[model samples]
Target chain A: MIERTATIASTVGLHARPASIFAEAAGAIDAEVTIARAGDPVDEAVDADSMLALMSLGVEHGEVVVLRTGDDTAGEALDALVTILETNHDA
Target chain B: MHSFVGVGVFRGRVIGPVRHMPPALAEPPVGERLEGSTAPETAAAALKSAGATVKELLQERASRAEGAGKEVLEATALMATDPMLIKAAIKLVNTGTSAERAIWEAGEAVADTLKGLGGYMAERSHDVLDVRSRIVAVLRGVPAPEIPDFAEPFILVAEDLAPADTATLDPSKVIALVTAGGGPQSHTAIIARNLGLPAVVAAAGVTGIADGTQVFVDGATGVVSTDPGAAEHAAVAEWQEKASLLSVFDGSGRLADGTLIPLLANVGGAKDAQEAAAANAQGVGLLRTEFCFLGNSTEPGHADQVAAYKGVFDAFPGKKVVVRTLDAGADKPLPFLTDATEPNPALGVRGYRTDLTTPGVLARQLAAIADAAASSSAEVWVMAPMVSTAAEAADFAALCTAAGLRVPGVMVEVPSAALTARHILDHVEFASLGTNDLTQYAMAADRQLGPLAALNDPWQPAVLALVQATVEGAVSQVKHSASLETTSPKPVGVCGEAAADPALAVVLAGLGVSTLSMTQRALPAVAAVLRTVTLPQARALADRAVAAASAAEARELVRAGLPALAELGL
Candidate 1:
């Protein structure tokens, strides 16, 4: 598996619209993606496609989080998800 | 009809069946485990199907929704179909837990986990609970515990409503709001004001009233009548007819004899200005400039203040825009402007006094207002709040002159300012009575404290006497006034919550207030009531008010003279 980390850019953190948008994007990708707080162990990661799991991560704005994908060709998917996390939806 | 009296925050009357927000569902009992007739697989299938059904229902609603509420429904729909939910339920069912118990336990586990995460996640716990309740209700063939899906409008009676509860409500469906407990500034009242629903708060025993009980709610009088007698039915019909007219403002503010009193709006920012413009406010009477300095750690730059003011100015081109300078300190303390704490902020360094410690702040804002005025078509008139002495008014007027703004004024919130209005108006152009502060200061009551709300009323004899003094003083200086473009000494106007009252508006007009600036919703009603009485009658009403022994007595006295008020249920 491969991974990437990016800071959440939404003013209210990865909440409401930002979280929903991120989760929907992760679900559309053909990989089994997982996310966790940057300092937490990879074993503690949750499904990136699940809104509940994404929210339960408590990823606040400007806080860094880790994104990982098990699929080989999905290395690009993690990068794109990182882009969503970095873009400020509120702005 | 039995009448329950409370504080009315909005205007109008409506009769509708009250809808109680559903009580929370009972916890599903820890019934027997999946055995015999109810197989574990069958239990698991039931939970999954319930989830699918709920998800489909929410998905359909979400598809038609918009904005933050739409996002809420969409997120909830995703939670309903969450695979983790069913997997956990199936695991519990396999462990011999009953289907109902498994679903409840699985939902609780997820909700508890979300709550534990806190912050944004904690709030999402509600979404889980919402979905959980929906799934359970679907399985049990019962309605979900939430706001109803009634076909017609209603009077939403509740003990109180949370922000979440109100978000799902369709404004059109709620004819009025009756709450058992809340103040004028409560969340329920704010929502009612935003929805333009006539509302009564602090209403006792309203929640006990059953659903589908037809009730008469007169928002102006704060009377919620359960019995719809023949006379009450006629009153409702009259209210509907007059209220329909009150909803459409002609943009002209005058008495029956055509004495003009420019009705204006009190706005905080550009958004409010846009709404006021749409509501056809004569112009902005009080442009509160606190939005900038309140949020910033330091004073906002001249350019930023200019840009902010320009948005409001753009909305009311070629109209009178009375802009009050930044009213910092007091209840609204800015770190850069005033001390962080005070023994008595109500009496401490506030309003125009904030400029004493930080001299350049007011100067910077005045220059910015002039800068913005230069670029826009609005007739920008600047005023300073809390001017206690004639020297302060003169000082403020000089500052306005230096900034190149033509019209300068001082708010008569301070009793001293109202008492010395003639001396102040000699230097300044006009005086606008901020009756909220005027009443609070005159009565020595903290306006924020709920218990002291009675003394803070504008109808207080002492408060009316002060308003009378301010107007008389301004009138005495009418012709000799340096700012006199017209001979009309209606120069002393009102721009407070008191000015919004229809009964009080007539009194202010009678007392010779030139303009009445209030919330836009009050404009049509005030105009409607003002049209009922000629200038001489309004003057007679003001006389009755001033002669009354107490505030309640004063209100009743003035309300009696204007039978049109009772006719329109003002």
Candidate 2:
């Protein structure tokens, strides 16, 4: 499994527009991906492709989250997801 | 013809076939378990398909909408297609819950979660619940609750329309508005007046009138008469001719004897100022400065205030622009300036009184107003609201002088100011009668309460008495300063909603009020009515108004006194 850490850049946090943009991008990729607050328990991770799941995590502005993928082909997909999380959709 | 009576708002007359607002959705039945309902798998499939269909529908609408509206529809569409919702619903269904109940429970759960977040996130709960209703309606084959859609113009009848319900209301397609519920200050009444449509509110039985039923709505008399015959048709034609006569203002206000009453506009900000200037208002009488203070956690700096005030002053060059200082607290509480938990804000620190608790705020605002006035050619007059005592008026006038703002004024909103008007006017150059607040203070009625709207009217004898007192006091101030024959009577202007009423404007003129400022749209009607009567005739009407026992009686007496008003269809 490959893991990456990306900080939320959206001023309003990982919810609303930013979360929707990130989740849509994640869902389009061909891999199993999950995300959670960086310091939280690994088992608490939720599917990254679900907009509601990403929002329910309540990850706020400038907070860091860990993205993990079990699929070998998901490296590039994880990078794309990280780019979305770090880009401020509000801007 | 059958007739129903309610309070009239605005003096418009229209006749059209009625169209009732669509019925709201009923709460769906829910239970712990599905007894003979569809199986879990079948229910899950149905839920999925319904969600997809709703999402598709919303997306299609979003494509046609623009700006914030399109964003809202798109966000709501996302809520419909949320996979987490289906997952939660299936989890509920696996525990023997019916599909409908499961969906509702899941939607509620998410909405509750959003609400708990508070502020911006909390507002999204409404969208989630809306999506839940659409999905449930799709499953049940029932049409979603929405605003009625029709091609031809029709009079809209409703049971108190909420903002959400009127999102799809096409204003152009609506001839007038009739509601079974709501007062003169209610949303329905206010929107109707703003749209310049005939509106009658608080008419209890008007909603029961069937769709496509022809009805005559007389907004002046608050009458909704059904099955109009020849007389009503003739009245409508007469009204149309009179309405045309109540035409565009010629930028001047005069009595039949040719006494000029400077007709000014009450503007909120720059946009309103520009519109008022275009409408040919003599000038702005009440430039509410709340736009600078409202929404700010801390006090706005001098530069921010200057920039904002400059936008308005720039609109009316060489015209009178009366700017009021930050009138915060009471109905308009500012976070940085007011106590949120005050027992009775209306009676407590409000308007000028806010400065007692937070000093330097009003001073800073005056400085800003002075700065904006310096660069603009507009004749800027500054005023303080809620000034009661001569001492309070003196302090405000001194502050204005200190800030280099000439022509200082005080608003006669409190009863003490009206009762002791001569003393208050001694301290300021001008006094403006704020009839809305004066009525509220005199009648001891909350202006916002629907049941108290009758008592809160300016036509109330007590309120009219206060107006006369203020105007008389201003004239008395002039007589007291007789040593300087060049000095004019301290002008007492009626800068309130009452001034918008054409009949009341004439009565105000009769009472010796020097200026009349109101909503720009009402300027022409008021100007039209004022030109029909001489100053002496207006004084006779004013005397009759002051002697009436109640608001309704006084309004009737005044309307009757102005026979030309009926000709103007007011």
Winning model by lDDT: 2
- Candidate 1 global lDDT: 0.83
Q: Rate residue B395 of model 2 by lDDT.
A: 94
Best by TM-score: 2
lDDT of 1 by residue, A1-91 (tens): 7889999998767766788788889889888898999989889998888777777666777899999887878878888999999998866
Task: Give per-residue CA lDDT, model 2, range B170-246, as digits (tens).
Answer: 77999888988777766676567656788898898987898899999999889999999888999889888877767
- Candidate 2 residues A1-91, lDDT tens each? 9999999998778877787788778878889799999999999998887776777788889999999999977788898888888898876
State the lDDT at B426 in candidate 2: 81
TM-score of chain B of each: 0.71, 0.80
Error of 1 at A14 (Å): 4.0
Cα deviation at B166, candidate 1, in Å, is 4.4
Looking at candidate 2 chain B, the ten consecutive residues that score lowest on lDDT are: B115-124
lDDT of 1 by residue, B229-278 (tens): 88778878887887787786789998899988889998889999999999
DockQ each candidate and list the results.
Answer: 0.39, 0.28
User: Per-residue lDDT for B280 in model 2?
Assistant: 90
